[model samples]
Target: MSIAKTLAALVVVAALAGAGITAPPTATAAEASPPRAQAGEEVFYHVFFRSFRDSDGDRIGDLRGLTERLDYLEDLGITSILLTPLQPSPFYHNYFPTDFETIEPKYGTLDDYFAFVRGAHARGLKVYLDQEIQYVGEGHPWWTRSQGFAGAPFADFLLWRDAARTEAEPFLDRATWPHYDGRQIGIAMIDLNNPRVRDYFTRVLLFWADPHGDGSGRDGVDGYRIDHMMDDLDHKGVATDLFAGFWRPVFEALRARRPDFRILAEQADWGFGEDWLVRGDADLVFAFPLRGALIDLDKDKIVQAVRETEAITQADKGQIVFLENHDTDRFMSLIDDDPARARAAAALSLLLRGEPLLYYGQELGMRGITREDGMSDSNHIPLREAMRWSAELDAPGAAIWYRGDKPWWTEPANRAHDGVSVEEQQGDADSLLAWYRTLLALRQARPELRGGDQRLPCGDASEVLCVLRESGDARSLLLVNLGDAEARPALDATIADDRWIDLIDGGTVDPSTLSLAPMTVRILGTP
Candidate 1:
């Protein structure tokens, strides 16, 4: 939080890079001028509900605990929050819902949920709920009653195989239901082809978007992150191809009420999503190819990836670029505690032309990655560990409730002694968290950085990559030296303006003579 401390951290970074310290002028009036880009490159912070803050000393995160941490999210300049499912379920993760309408008691009552929505809205943070509509837990009434004899009333709710050709038979009456077996789950897939079943989910969505059926306009989420979406919501993996007919109408019906509402799809097979997602009415999908390049530090692939991202990312639809998340390995695993690797990757992720996102503890450089050691969901345990408030593992903010479920191979990316805790980083301006603050603030200050047509000026450089972001009356340059040695990038077109401001390093620069230290990132604006 102090200017002097930040300079000291930057000096430490310089020492780490093995370069001479040439301090840049600290940006004192970054907020003086508003960016030309509308909203100027906003970011989303994804919170794994159970791994986040906990209240009432339960050693488990709840809506109340999350509400208490709104200021922390606000300080990070996050414009949106994406939450995992909060509906009642038998599972610890709450994915397969036993009851779609009720909030989990462990997460708090419905009253707590409304309070959280109001609290987040008051802070100008748009909240998006994550929903898993594909299945219901074994304990769900739909599953319970339907699996019985004597003509189940809600038998049509699920995809069940049967000999009788009755109306209650599943859409895929020929194929049996999927093997409902997984760690912490044994669930039945929903029959999306059933009009009644589709209607049920539609109501569930509407309830969350606008809790009060009345026109009071309160206690609702801004949008939704739909889970495990596919074209064929068929029974037992059979091709029903109901998405176009079933999904389009659902989105259209929702938009008729809330026109500006957004929808994101977890298109696991993202290779085909570039074409498939738009058809399914998804506004955003995960960008996997570019992310792979970033994690490997492959500069050439990253260049091609930027081109590919620009090709698919349109005004109405785009990709959401993220490095660390609950389902995937933490970016810190690749970083291995090196400041250069972290800074370079961050630069590429933040500056690339797409919607940027961050996992909750990614700013503190949290590390973990699930492994394929012939184990199941146990590998995910490391990636979803508790937040590091201080150094002590048993500290108050460390909710180690789920730590008991950790697999044998689970390894913490960082420890309290590693000085990666928020308390430790809060003292140093040059910390990874501080750099994130500067990068996010820079995106807010420079419209071109967020809104411009991006082009890589350096052609096929093995170590250095330069992205030229240009908009009318605003121009900015993002340079990164990903290689071990020093690298200099040049623009194909000459910069008539010689003076520039370093948005991250807080210094002045001349683009023509600029040199990037190893694993360094520079965002320079024309002066």
Candidate 2:
């Protein structure tokens, strides 16, 4: 048989299986029910469990705090909560995990963790944990005790090399490194090679998720976000045999229990060229390229990065696009603290393809950066500023969430003018926060923007970046001017007149001059 025919036959088989129509053709009567939400149909919230505050200033964000915000999230149409590590760890970020099974005491107790999960589930929100297993503190119990590190083969886990035996070799400075604070950073790297390590890892996962583990496990976790995947672990290279052999089984077990399980990886550089997005490890990968394109100063490089990333990933690739995330410098700060540019970037992300993440204060134009301090806390600035709720202060209470008090870093002086509070922007149609709402609503209204056939329109000049998106009955044209001047592309000679319509400027037709302000983005849709 021809290759095409064979491929077509396989697709048919897969479709039949998906439909539950077996070879003998047993068909069950359809139950009247609502359709499951499509991929990318659901929105997610990235919360800092430690930063959120209430009436009492405990300096720690807890499960109750997360639960309190569930209504807000549900009201905003958020279907999932991507909770950062809930496990006990020394650091604020929860990367250096000491115990995978227990909830961090600072955050909450195990009961508190379960209560949050229960509340989210009651509100139809899927809960997923951010698992950071790439490296553990040098003081992890397994590393300190002789027998704790004994079960695995020599190659399973990682070791902190105290000294280098050869001149041409890689070594970790045990003296000055592996220390989050003056503490021993007792996170011992787990040897992945040891069958024992695998057993422990599996047990940890099952302990939290396996409802049957304790004589009837209630529900396993919905998904996971693997952190620091780029760092080599257990000698498995990023794009090679390691992930395929080790991580694959753990994922498979979870999928077998809940087919709806979703996994995202924090392999920031993966989107650059690696085919890991759909290579079985993760359901989705962070769209670092899109983030880079939005913030990088170089105009040409930004466009090239977008084009290259789009070319590599498959059409169904699950990637999250964002202007800023938790760890990075705030987008507002990166855009010269200009609210206008920040609004434009937010608009572009909503209208573009893929799932987009909006860091907590991004809607309010929060500005902050890492300081040059040896202390980790000093270096890592808080994106979650205090919420300004007073209308008497001339700040918009219900507009957008803003930092009331100044964060540990630089802050906006004129909170009213810089769009720093949500209350002010909520009502103003021209407000940056309002623009984001409209943009996201547009994504919901237009399926083409969600998942469409995208094309970069040919421009008269090399400096212009013109793109088109079409899916089924919907179509859109995105014209981004990365350069400094207004770009007028002769459209009359370029596009078919009857096929396109401009939604932004009252149905303006193509083949006319496309004006793009410096660093501006224009969206045109068919009427």
Candidate 3:
């Protein structure tokens, strides 16, 4: 081996030996298990905990705040709330955990979480927690004890290397490891192959899934959104087969307890595929590539991607389709803040055939985006900024970014706070927020639109991408002009009944042909 490679191997081996990890952790099918992770056709609202609401007046959002908003969410037509990580962490974005069992104090206590859960359940809303089991933050007891101590119980918990950079080569900072999403975000990848770690995490999940230890199964979460759900270790041998064996057993155990619990995976790759089902047993995976198409406001890309997603997904498994989530920039930033484009994007995402997930403040056109000039880690904070409740600076419930008391984020490039609020949009019939309410309310009233097969009606045309969602005898046609000017697409008059009905505003459409306004979407149904 070259001197550098040889030295590297030695350094890793030394660290491992000193950490008391003689070998990799052992695994078995018996080690992993779940609550039957059930994801029925329901609309989801994704909320970043700290940014959503602050009931304590501490400038940070808490469970009390979340609980108080359940009525609002229910009214908004969302059936569930997909929360970002709430585990204790040193960072503002709590993807990495210092402790999994405890809730971040800023968010509230365990009692608060359970209360929020019970409250959501009362409102007939399901809640799913974001579970990122792959990474650990700086001060986690496991990391400190395993790396520095001689007899570390968690020595097998982390991925380490060997060779010649001294004994401390492998147990370095995130910049040196950069194991997550190909970014050095101050986190270290766990050695997921270790069955002991798997068992430990399973216990953690089970604890949350059934926090009350009661047989009722109502106090815990509906399921989990698994972060960075991967198949195996990249460069390592033997451990590459860990995912199938590890996740299956875990899921089996969970289902043994609660049959209806839902588990969704944020798989590494996002396209037409069912690999996550057979390999990892994840019930649903985020359809990222399709989401990419919607963000561009491209008619063809979005239409084709939706049709492809529906075709590829199996009956038992599904793809969670979304235009904006916590990880990506707000849809407002992507669509150039045009109200028309926002309306078009909302219709494309929420109306299409998939489990729709709407980010909090998405209805009010909440906007935030990271700049290219900023450091990579610093960029996501923009997208995760406070949920703007009102444009009024002194409003009692107005949100402030939690990075600092008063930071540089106070002045954002997008300036998302202007005129975007529940107060402003509540009564405005033509507002963007009003548009979301209309779309979600439509989903609630129409069973066909909720869980139906999607079809592209205007195959012969490219400028206007028309989609037809049908279930039983009920059908809805979504027409959008993807250009600056009007485009008329000729269709069989028989596609609709003698009279056409627009679901958004109860307007009428010509049965023989459709003329679309610029950057507009029309929902045509038989009246």
Candidate 4:
């Protein structure tokens, strides 16, 4: 009846269930029993193609560089690599595609791309290509057709906004809101109403998803990270219909072939809630609402934001956690440079519902703001400030920040003297990086922390924000002191009875009452 007793019962039942489910072999197991993606556990890696250096000192980052980093990625427990577009785009970011079939030569040959995929698969890492279908580069061959692009039902595929109504319609105005890459000569809006265009788009997607070249030439792609999906205009008032139509066949087809294939849609806003599931295509959506609050100065404010996110998004917290991604300003800079607060945010991110994305430098206390250089410039590459790798910079259960060539955007703040490098932080047991890694590991080790029907463990949810995640009998509790000063909050440890173990501090917690340090976060569960 009590929370502890309920949790103990659940654990026993789970053990019985798992006992019947034969355990997979260890790392030394044969190839046939190779590791697989853990359910409810997914990791995404954001790779910038142009920001890498080849062995020859070439300025471009190619598939080979990524291939080489597979172990590094695997070490971090990343399950998938979300590559920025590899298509032949005129710019370095690869978002503006000139050729869908070709890998950017600057990033190496198509063969290199193939090798990267093969390498990733070898490491059991699924690869997801960034799909930016809303727009194409100004120089795409389709735009060059002189017949005004009349290809059967695809004639209206490329949209041509009414020149007269351009003043009233904001999305149609091209000259004013140019693309991020300067080379964009004009706007790249396509006519989603055209079925032919839709079919063509589907064909392209299917082509990539087919590993046998049965549809196009390439084999199946494991997953697709749809880009700027929210940017397209839905003249028919059924935006979900259009995007879903474009994807339903592809997703169904891929699942029919590779059942484990994933689709992570970029639903930056909250509109795609039901459609994401109805379409049965996307496995994940960017939790932007959560990102907007994670950086707020007030911990209470952040917790309140989390509660709202749980309510508004209608997504199972276990499936839709927040992330500070490549598109946004770094979390550190956005949070006013408070390292402790940053750790608190990190704790919430790793412990809360949904999956968490560790943007490259995020582990190293990196900081930077949104700038005109574009998202890639602001948070991805330019923020790659030098990371400390000295023995002193290590963190328990954490990997070194920069195991390879320094990224192009190395920060001056992370220089040797500041003692912020991975090496320096590694030495300080309470370093932000260490705190993040420890809390993350703790969250992963406990099933209750993964999110389920949540219960506020503390008597007062607002002041001390105590949350309990439970599935059947498995339970994990997260407690944060939202108040500025030390506050001891009382809680029903058992929901029915008061007893808990403060996992973070390694102390037995009597559910009836507990004192939380200012902005403190603790994970509690039976070992």
Candidate 5:
């Protein structure tokens, strides 16, 4: 069936169900209907465009390459994608933008970006563009015009330490870095206190949210991932307390223009990020504490993290949960490449009470860590290496941007014949990729796992972490063995009364007699 027809049929089915005319006859009075769509139900895949796939074979991943991979993402069951910064930048990561309005020349043109968005939307997937508007490189017109020009139009655009505008306000240590053009250029923090700067970004955000200004948003991005979001502006004491003054206004403006637009914030401190969601008017915040807890594999720490997350996140807002991202070391490396631990981590990530984020290549057990060489921009290359598509690691679509003479490619995580590529894992039932697909499918089929409230049970068992998910009349229990040995944790009497259908293996089992293998997860739903 065509996508349009499928969508239309779904709408009709939803309308009939709302009218109380459609439901299975066997559904009991205690059975819960499908849960409504919520922000936390979305599963997002984070993609670094420069490392995902390359279409033109310039060794760099681009918009066209990403567009071609929409089928893969959709089949993997992710509802959204969070792309790294796409604006023209002086850095390979594209975080330090020189131009915010246009696409990077290496990626593609604006038309290509629009086409990609359209293709993603047609597949019922959301596209979230990453925005790092707080800092501008020396190549930015605002920075170039403000330098040494007393009456320049953009003189107040950047924050300077002196009236002469010779020294830019320090971002970390140095205010200047070598641009892609091989010349040292100044990097200046934007004066968020200035109303003009706030209004400029508001316009930029709105443009991306509705590119043609038709309010249809068909060709535009669905949301934005704000990078390094901060209220104190790196604690420099320059742009202080921007939540109420700067960000709230911009977010309000964007929402006024596009009510359904989403803003996912990355807190600079990597804390709970409650302030970003409550005060900054953000819809989603990163669950950095939960991520750390999950990687440590401590049951108490994991329970505590879940409690803290539940306490802070509102019903309308959500947290983005993940095991690893572009900035963090791979989960496989963190766990010493243990396949069982990796599978358990995947279960926790998808089953947690938040919007799960899957980093590209994470499902394939790809491993990488930070390489601290002296060369600028080379340190992060290892973590952002190419995606492994074939057993030989030289497939046509593989993005080998960091190859040749670089230490990153020499000792790369994606080795040939390593059984970590899509080609190797496609038909392997026990592969990490297959495990991810199963978890994703289960999460989709069970509404309780998606929009349910999480309660940590089995607290007495220190080696096992248990989470009871409840939404309306639906309930499910997730038992995870965090220990290295087998764990036979007893469930609460109230929860153990009902027989459970093992969602993983499709077998009936009693919850009271649950036994978990080492580093494994079992999801049980009330039968």
Candidate 6:
């Protein structure tokens, strides 16, 4: 089908589905409900496409494969999917793009991408594409042409370190690196101060926001995640004050086109991200401090981080609360594969004030850590290993793209028959995947958990982290034991009335007499 026709059909189906008539048979229970009206209420799933699923026998994940798994995301109650960069690149992660306008050939064609977006929309899911327009690979047309020529067409596209224009300013360290194809290439940072470069990237972002230019956005991404966003552009002293001058303009143009378009920024400095939210005009930012505190499993640290975050963040803006992403080590590995701690982390993430982002394979308790082998792109293979769909690591839907090529695959985390695959945990009630599902379902059912004001109520209890969520008349309390011993935290007397119900296990309890097992979670609310 043509892109326009496919989008039209999706819209009609979505309309019918929304009206409680003629719903798709494949739709899960989560899809039968109305779509989230506000972006802050969404539960986002971050996907590294190359490691998600494989449709063909090429052992690489593609758009078609992801489209085929929409049911899984719906069943998990994910309202949105944040995809990593899909542009053509010479690297495995596709962070630095060779071309901004085209989809990676290994992933699929433009038609396949349109189909994926359409399928997601039909399931009441929003798609957000990741863009790293701050830099380009050596093979990019802009970088290739400006290599030696002084008066090249795009010579001003990149920031050069010399008057002769023969050297490009390095961002992370070196300006040159070996490409995946074993050829040395320059990693040129874009000249955001240049008006022409800024306009070119703005056009690129707008094109993806509405691929067909019909303004319906049915076949286009709903938003964007700006990767490695910085104000000073690597502190090279060029392209300075980008939050006010460069990013705000691009964001304004995008918002002008689509009023509700969301912009998530990954702050380069990884601080509290207040400046990025206020000055850069970002709607959401990664909760780096909260993530560190959670990983540390320290109650004091977690509470302090939450208080600081609430102080700086505005009520309208939000943080993308998460345990792991493409760049970080998996949460399971960080916690030594402790199931109870994992469950507590899940509860805190979903029941927190901000929108929660679950990294792909996080539900299955997948484990990995960064390798210290070298500085090459291959060093991150362990952290970006394939999603475990079945007990056999090489199963049909498993995208084991780096199987034999990387030695990290043989680690205990990636071992077969480790009970970390969806197939192994689907029917097990006490499994980590089931724990995640339960928390997600609870978040979907309760409005207070979605967008409520958070308050820490565990007074003097060093081992327990208590979060009280209130949305007008609706109120819920999430108590998580971060310690290895049992905890009976003292709660404020005004927290509950006559009786409180356990939302997870479904029972009445007295809030004053509450007790939590080691590394467990209990969500309590009025009966």
Instruction: Give the Cα lDDT of each candidate.
Output: 0.70, 0.56, 0.70, 0.56, 0.80, 0.81
lDDT of 1 by residue, 32-136 (tens): 322212232557799988878778677778889899888888787677899989888766677878877677777786557767877777777778899887778
lDDT of 6 by residue, 1-527 (tens): 22222344333333223222211112234334445447789889999989999998788999999999999999988899999999887787887888776778889876788678768887788999999988988688787777767799888988888877888776568977764345666677888989887777776676677553445454567899999899988877887989877899999988877888999999998989999999999999999999999888788888889889888899778899999999999999998988878888888877888889999999999988887755666666777788888999889978888776446555635778999998999999999888888888888888898887789987774577889988888888888888788888677778745467999788788866767788878888864
Q: Please name the candidate that would achieve the greatest TM-score relative to the true structure.
A: 6
TM-score of 6: 0.92
Residues 1-527 of candidate 5 have per-residue lDDT tens digits of 21122223232223223222211111122122222234667999999889998999898999999999889998888889999998887788898888776678888865577678767777778889999888887688887877887578988988888899866775666866653234665668989999888877776676677643445554567789999999889888899889999989988877776777889999888999999998888999999999999999888888889888878988788899999889999999888889988988899999978899999999999989877654355666777878887887667878887777556767887688989898999999989999999999989988888888778878665577888888887888888888878787667788888778988788888866767788878889975
- Clash pairs (backbone) in predicted model 6: none
Query: How many residue pairs clash in model 4?
Result: 21
Per-candidate clashes come to: 2, 32, 32, 21, 0, 0
Residue 460 C-alpha lDDT in model 2? 46
Better of 1 and 5 by lDDT: 5
Give residue 21's lDDT in candidate 2 (0 to 100). Answer: 20
Per-residue lDDT of candidate 2, residues 325-442 (tens digit): 6678778777787655776677666666667776655666666666555644435544444433332223222222222453342343224344565555667777666666666666
State TM-scores per candidate: 0.85, 0.76, 0.85, 0.76, 0.90, 0.92
Output the better candidate (2/3) by lDDT. 3
Off by over 4 Å in 4: 1-33, 52-56, 147-156, 161-172, 175-184, 213-220, 231-241, 268-281, 297-308, 311-319, 372-429, 459-462, 493-499, 502-507, 511-513
Which parts of model 6 have CA positions greater than 4 angstroms off?
Answer: 1-37, 178-184
For every candidate, C-alpha RMSD to the true structure in Å: 13.1, 10.6, 9.7, 11.8, 9.2, 5.9
Between prediction 3 and prediction 4, which has the larger TM-score?
3
Q: Comparing 5 and 6 by TM-score, which wins?
A: 6
Let me know the TM-score candidate 5 reaches against the reference structure. 0.90
lDDT tens digits by residue: candidate 4, 379-423: 343343322333332222222223344333233333344555555
Error of 2 at 231 (Å): 7.5
- Using lDDT as the measure, the top candidate is 6
